[model samples]
Target: MMQVIYDPLLPWAAIWASAAGVVLIVALALWRRLPGWWLRGLAGAALLAALANPSLQDEAQTPLSDIVVLVVDESASQTLSDRAVQTARAIDEMERAIAGLENTELRVVSLGDAPGDEGTLLMTALSEAVAEEPRGRLAGAVLLTDGRLHDVDRAPDLPAPLHVLLTGHEDDWDRRLVVENAPAFAILDEEVTLTLRIEDQGQAPAGDGLVELDVAVDGGAVRQVRVPVGEDLTLPLTLTHGGTNVIQFTTPAAEGELTDRNNTAVVQINGVRDRLSVLLVSGEPHPGERTWRNLLKSDSSVDLVHFTILRPPEKQDGVPVSELSLIAFPTRELFLDKIDEFDLIIFDRYKRRGILPAIYFDNIRRYVEDGGAVLIAAGPDFASADSIYRTPLGQILPAAPTGRVIERGYLPELAPLGERHPVTAGLPDLAPPGAEGAPGWGRWFRQIDLDPRAGQVVMQGVGDRPLLVLDRVGEGRVALLGSDQAWLWSRGFEGGGPQLELLRRLAHWMMKEPELDEEALTATAEGQRMTVTRRTLADEVGELEITGPDGNVTTAPLQEVAPGRFQAEVTGPEIGLYRLSEGDQSAVIALGPAAPREFEETVASGAALEPVVARGRGGIVRLEDGVPSVRQVREGRPAAGRGWIGVTPRHAYVTSDVTVTPLVPAWLFLVLAAGLSLGAWMREGRR
Candidate 1:
């Protein structure tokens, strides 16, 4: 190709000034009525033109192919119904049409669902594809999706028209249950309200028809209830236990619903105790008296009600009871009236005396049998005939004390069962008094000898006697600590042990915290990865049964990470609720969200991309009718018609080589100017 180019000998500013001078000279000559004024003016114009150089450019060029982006949506929502099939067919037809156009290149970019619970990001994918290609060569962009994009604000500035081939029928619909709001943490035993509603999308059924809902907590017995469709249901939920409570709400599939993936929702509410009321009845004010008190009082969440038996009835100090500073013990109020109000009752070195009657002891036994917790920190009193175990509570007590109490120093060690028990499973070993190179913690000097009759002995003391025994009686839980020197650890006697942590776990376990369950199943999610944990008291665990958001089941064997702690991890391909179970234990953990954002709206629509399409002068055509024919359209013109989608012809090219030559020699311009001047002069002379 040859084109005129220029390498001016003077600056444009100087050239423009010379042209103005020439024009002025011509005007003055014509005003004075000079002979041959037209010829003279033409010569001056040619002189000014010589100063401004012009050249002819010849070049070798290569025509670059025009790029047409075909963005296909393979997101989770598009996989439902016939949208997947429609998308596949559209891609094939668009590819064929683009191939037929000369100098046109097809760029296919497939957009799947975002990681975890994030919805389809079709605009994000489009912006990336545009950035990778040359903007000048972009002929147009075509989207083959259902138009349920979550990142519409990230739409790219298009150089050409943008067209969309919509999938799915207009009549397709879906019924999804939405959990509008739920508290992440709720007070234990308090009612928390959950805002929920069943929504109808597209052509979904609408009416007052009842939708059956099954609500379960930690995979317990499901409570069935019927709620009207499309109405907000404020369901009252109460957390039964502390720690992570999985509350699953599920509704059976409605007739003609698109999919049941959105019909179920899982909510995890962490239950926290408002305040733990502990009634501490101390038999005497010993050195360890402040140990239990400090442990309970240091925790701001615990309300401690401590009472010490300063003087027994058998020991008379010759002081009147009314005049004494000691406050009267409210046995009737504590043992009978408000016993159930206390979460834990700790008897610190408390021996049976004339203070409480046999009926009161029976009442205490009944309290424990009815889901109450008790901790017996025995001392020398446990071996006495007046021990509380000799009363009605003895029937439920885990161990019976011998007639002797050993006062020799002994190192407390974890029993074999304790290695598997949740309470003392991972406790660090402490130095025993002054022995061993490992720097073990403290040791107790007093341990009450006892013979275990029921329950598991988790810790042992001198002569392998039960130091800590945990048992379940009726619906309640109890623990017995055979020594009173737990305070030695608090005093840092030969480097303190894990007394605080041990007591904390013991208290929480007795109170029935779900995480401290001896045998349990739980799951945690981070992005697409899910870590499944199975905690048990046995030597080994079997394979875990995992049910996905869909009804499909997958089994993965649990690997023993620690003693009695088994784990299995799997990365989910999609997002939604998952059911994990092993034998009689089960847990429901939502991998992404209760109701995934992808499934929130399953119907196909072009509303999300309408603004983007309009800005590029493109149109949306439904594939349900037929595949639109591809055609070329001019810039700024509508790129779609009834049955055709248009792609703009960019005519992009690159120059490989070029040569520049002056259009005419400088000498030639001077000769032309002189000839015209002489011709005018001869004509004037002849006239």
Candidate 2:
């Protein structure tokens, strides 16, 4: 390139002032009718031009190649139907076409799924790619995608046009199940409403408008229901147990749908109990009776109904009934009518008194068998002739008292099975028996000798006798503590044991908390990585089987982390629900959102990028029609057409070298001025 430039020898203000003075002098001579005015003016102009030196510049230039960004969408949705193949073909054709164009290069940018379920960030990728190249050199951007981008707001201001090569057929359709609304927590045994909708996108086929929806909880039995499509359905669900409840809703894949990945949705609603209702019946007052009272009363969520049998019916102690401070026990209200209302019933040192009728005892037994919990803190009364074992309640008791009470200080130690039981496992950080033949916890002064009939012995006393036995009766649970001296631990006797922690676990376990289940399968996820855990009382667990979102099955060997806890980590390549099973235990956990943003809508369209493309005077062409030819066009003209897409030729260049030559030598201007001035003086003298 060549251009004329200036190098001023004086300030602009001084040059302008000197030119004004010369013009005034010429005007005065002209007014006076002098013959040398024009000559004098010419001399003055020559001298001023010398001060303002002008030069001709020529630049050595190199043309830079135009950068055409080929943003390829490799997100999860792009893999649906024939989109992947179409994308591949479009990329190949574009690469070849850009290579054919003179001084044009294709910059292929492969865009994958965004992290944390943000879906396909095609705009984000395009913006970044454009930022890496010079704005002046960017020919245009071509995106080969399904066009289901999630981050359209992040679109960058492009100096060049943007074209989209959409990659799906016009008739492509998809059916997806969407959970519009769901609660993160629901009250146990109460109904919670969930809003759901079924949507069909693209050219969907005609149907009955009713789809079969399958609903399952905790990966259990699936219940199917037919519901209308395109309308929100309110599902009323009641959580039966406490802890995390994984509810899965699935609609079977249609015949012509693009993919079945979105046919299922999972919702995790934590089940929480409103309150715990405990009935504490003390046959006689003892030091441990207050211990049970304090434990139950301390929990703000527990409603404790306690009654101490201070005066039995058989005792006629000459005391007036009105003068007595104790109120009569409501046997009919507690044991007969409202037995099912209480979550747990504790018989603390209770004997078979005539107070509760035989029918009442039978009702209590029935309560235990019908999803109710019972705990027996045995005293000497448990082994006496008046023992409750002789009553109808004895049928559900796991152990039978042997009519023997051993009175000796002995450490209450965990049995081998206790090391695996969730209630006793890793309790209070107590060490195992060492060379001193004693555990780290305190000791109890008395233990009732009992013959084990059923259930697992979790704790043992002197002579390896059963101190604590836990068993399940039908849907309910029962636990027996062979000694009432747990209060000794509460009093910090001989370095007290984990009295509070142990009782908490025992209570929660008997109440059927999911975390305290004897055998369970659970999983947690961080990004695409998953950790599967299996808790069982067995000596060893088998390999864990994992079912991924894509219905791919794989197995991972479980490593024993603790006595009965086994764990294994697996990578889930896709973001969706993962089902894990080990033996009979099964768990369903979502690696990300149950219905990921990618599969939320799988049909291909250019709506998201339409506004952006139009703003740049570009067009969208479907790959199904055919890959368009690439051509060069003017910057502001339309960059896409029916059969071709155009890239603007920037013709941008870099100046490698510069050369400047003065238009005229300064000495020439000086010589011309001197000659003009001499001529003007001779002409004036002659006049």
> Using lDDT as the measure, which candidate wins?
2
Writing each residue's lDDT as its tens digit, candidate 2 over 1-687 gives 999998989998898999999999999999999899999999999989998898999999999999999999998888788888898888889989999999999999998888888888888899889989999899899888988988899999888889999988899999988899999999999999999999999999998899999999987898999999999999999999787798999999898899888888889999999999999999888999988898888999899999988777777989987676467788899988999999999999999888998899999899989899999999999999999999998999999999999999998888999989999999737533432335677788999999999999999999889999999998899999999999987787767878878888888888888999989998887888988889999999899998887789999999999988999999887777888999999988987777788888888889888999998898899888899999999978888888998999999999999999999999999999999999999999997
Candidate 1 structure, TM-score to reference = 0.93
Candidate 2 collision pairs = none
User: CA lDDT of each candidate?
Assistant: 0.87, 0.90
Global lDDT of model 1: 0.87
Cα displacement (angstroms), candidate 2, residue 256, comes to 1.7
Per-residue alpha-carbon lDDT of candidate 1 for residues 505-526, written as tens digits (9 for 90 to 100): 9988888888888989888888
Residue 253, candidate 1: Cα error in Å is 1.5
Report the poorest 10 consecutive residues by lDDT, candidate 2. 428-437
TM-score of each prediction = 0.93, 0.96
